[model samples]
Target: MKITGDHQLIKKINKYLVLDTIRRQFPISRADISARTGLNKATVSALVNELIESSFASETGLGESSGGRKPVMLLFNERAGFAIGVDLGVNYMLAMITDLSGAVVKKKRIDIAELEAGALTDKLKKTIRGLMPHVPASPYGVIGIGIGVPGLVDDQGSVLSAPNLGWTDVPLQSILAEEFGVDVVIDNEANAGALGEKEFGAGRDVSNLLYISVGMGIGAGIILNDTLYRGFSGFSGEVGHMALAQDGPLCGCGNRGCWETFASEKALLVNARAAYDDAADADAAAPNLDTLLSLARQGDPEARRLFADTGRWLGTGIANLVNVFNPELIVIGNRMSLASAWIGEAVYETLDSRSLAFHRSRASVAYSQLGHSSAALGAASMAIQRFFSTMKATWE
Candidate 1:
């Protein structure tokens, strides 16, 4: 009986290692796990069997042979648990459900005009309840939830003045954890966007990069030496509020001439409205930015000019970022990249004029490949990474 119990404990330890290996590098074979982890083939096979029995992993058919019998592949059982990623935007909330491999199985967009703490919490609870029907059930249960709120979230997940959301001192993490009965992580949206780009998008391979998310407001996610650089008080990447133009437009953050006031989607929309209101066309009084984008796409000279000006402002910001950090890449995200052709030229123009040649030569700017979905995608990746990290920590 003592020997049997010891064997069971050893089996459990090895099984967890197998499951973790599969979670980190899925679509792998037992032999590959053995080779990478330096575990004997017999032990790997036995641990894989336990994981399969516990529904933590599923066997794939086969891999290419190398002068031996074909190896059976394995992947994490994505259906074993569900994770939710919420992008709490100034104008809307985007909630997405993704599996273990970061594939979005379902998504919902909720319109939010006012961001009263109580009302927003109620809405979030309802949104999660509404999404419960879509979640897949398995052994480990829904591991955790991640939220990307557009503000300075402290380490404990308290909101510190999300000006656009009208939030202050909101215990967002605790509230969500109580409601969901799971772990919750809340972070700045731009930081989340940076994490997303590094893990699954543009900065996957680059050691140093900046992901600039120009949404309703401008924000940046900085990755230096391949890690998210959240400085003191988790507010390092709040570069949007940096002073750019003296005595320019006042920002909602109670600042004058903030970079976001000149470079954000809100800025573009505000400028478009001003331009439209003064246009010769009488039908230009509509309050839709998408319409403005469409008009610009159709060769409206005024709209094109507005986008170019916005792009230049964005490029100026990028030049400053490059001058400071000297990253290898800069990813322009949100709807800002919608006008990439125009913005690309403006970005190059500013870089050519202002940035030092050495810094300019090192950085290559590009539009976010994932486009507007970068934040929510990053939130999903956050959930997965947190889960694996927690598992590894526990094992250690």
Candidate 2:
């Protein structure tokens, strides 16, 4: 007896396959796609025609042919739609707009003051409203919104808790989706950063990588075999709370000796202020990351030492992660990436000395290639992924 396949599912999958193929290898002919994906020429032709009709793919002219008439070449219509991605930090928010292909078209960053849940929601609404008009006239016009928050988020797109933001159980996803009338995605900033790196930055070349976002706090985004590992309950990457010393500085999470208290940007500032206070230095006009970075650039010994110490601690935590995960690459991202010149050597030295030689031998470390844009871009990519998965290309 013969069996029948689900025609709609098969068509969706085939269309998606053809779209993805064009996106990756555009200026390609349908024959090439048939060869690459092993779909029949007629099926590929039908799917490509449908994609062209949907404005997702376009003919770019004829291609060079060996004998017969030149075949028409195609290009993925990246500008056919746009997406919004937001990286919400404790003190700042960076919003960006990217085409379907993940190329940033516009971005804006605003400093955030202390605000409660209600006020924060209002602020986010305003920000989203502000970005909507600049989305560039496209077919899908802001297909969706993706946000990376520096906290825990449930699978439902709600921000479970953002301690630094003083937010807990905020139904941010629903709020945004309702307000904007578009799909919304919410995830931990570290996870977003990791995804961002994996998709478009340094980790693109490696299958297993760890993206560590070090800002006011430190959190990790684990990628195992090219996939983001969110862990049980969608609340992993809280490496900040990893205890380092039996007795160390108290963290806001009600724990002492947490990794962030010793290695994060907050840690650097805290130590900087203390050092300046101890020395009675007149330059203690409130040292933030910028000030410390300037001091280091000016060859301040104390600043150098402070950065070195932070790097050493960062290395210690990373060494522990390396031994456990054995990832091919560890990307240090977020606010701390700005201090790469000052802290890189120290981090490498410490990681080398602390990690097991066998594990250390295969793993390499690098700073974020996307710089501050990692989370935002990654968030946009998440939105894009959801869009594709739900857009008739998936069962949903």
Candidate 3:
């Protein structure tokens, strides 16, 4: 994979290389970008000028030179454009607007009482409309919209199935694109969460990582060689549906003994309700997740036991991932991660008992640094990446 001969292609690649160098090392001189990318000074200057004209980069104050005259520093212009990112959960939707650098400019969340596709789409459109007016004037106003759905999505952005939302064969990307007149990118929430963590959270330094989103259900996002590993048909990383028992509890995906049935937030809540029902003094009503977490933090024995059980189950699934993927890091996120203090212990203990010594030793488990915002932030980052790639194409 050497890029040979095509002069235009070479120039395009060099332009992106220089842009990336400047992005990573901001307020840097053209000479430094040339030095870092091994591109000649003249080429670097040309690319820098193009970037400035395109409003992608800006010239800041001059920097002290080692020998001759001071050099003008270049900065990646984050406000050149904006992107919208949405995390569509089963019961709620989180949306955020961000600049090219992924810094969130505005954010909103709406709770959904109905799961119908039409209703959800309506809410989504309304939210986008509200955000649109706030976007500042730029070269590419609202360059794109990226969405993370809790379901199986295809390469073309069709949501194949979102069982929790009762959606099937939903053309979310096309719908949004037609409605808003902007490019829309869609992916599974877990995959988006993985990207979010990789770009801004716990997995930032690692090339091989796994992000497990454990909310109402569980799903995993896999990253290999610092790239998302979407398998054939873009349907990989559905770890929640992996069978763990032959005759266990039924799962929403029409399977029994699925991993999520035993380890997800839904599972934890079910277990908590059962525990409450068993106690003589227990109230008839079930406690919410926050209340349950509070009880556990207060040393409620039953809550502790339930979380421990879920943690062990979570660890069992993670062990399988470790043995198969050999990831350098595993990040646990979504609502369930609030119990990581207990779940983490059980995960480690289970890995120690069940996982291969070599495989388990190489991987470290961590909680998500971005918490609930991971998916939305990741979606925005995806849009930003797409915008830059499109910009590169025009350069050629």
Residue-level lDDT of model 1, residues 67-92, one tens digit each, is 89998889888777778888888888
Q: What local lDDT does model 3 show for residue 18?
A: 88
Instruction: Score candidate 1 by TM-score against the native.
Output: 0.89
Clashes of each: 0, 0, 0
Clashing pairs in 3: none
Q: Which is better, 2 or 3, measured by TM-score?
A: 2
**Which of 2 and 3 is the better model by lDDT?**
2
Clash pairs of candidate 2?
none
* lDDT computed for candidate 1: 0.83
TM-score of each: 0.89, 0.96, 0.95
Q: Residue 49, candidate 2: how far off, in angstroms?
A: 0.3
State the displacement of the C-alpha of residue 334, model 3, in Å, after optimal TM-score superposition: 1.2
Q: After superposition, how far is residue 55 of candidate 2 from its true place, in Å?
A: 0.5
Model 3: how far residue 185 lies from native, Å: 0.2
Candidate ranking (TM-score, best to worst): 2, 3, 1
Highest TM-score among the candidates is held by which one?
2
Top lDDT: which candidate number? 2
lDDT of 3 by residue, 1-396 (tens): 355547878899899998888877898999899889899999999989998998889999999898989999999998889999998987778999999888889999987778899988999999989999888888878999999999999888999998778899999999999999988999999999999999989998999999999988899999999999999878999999999999999999998999999998888888888888879867743656787788889898878888899999999999998999998999999888888887889988997788789988888989999989889999998988888888788885
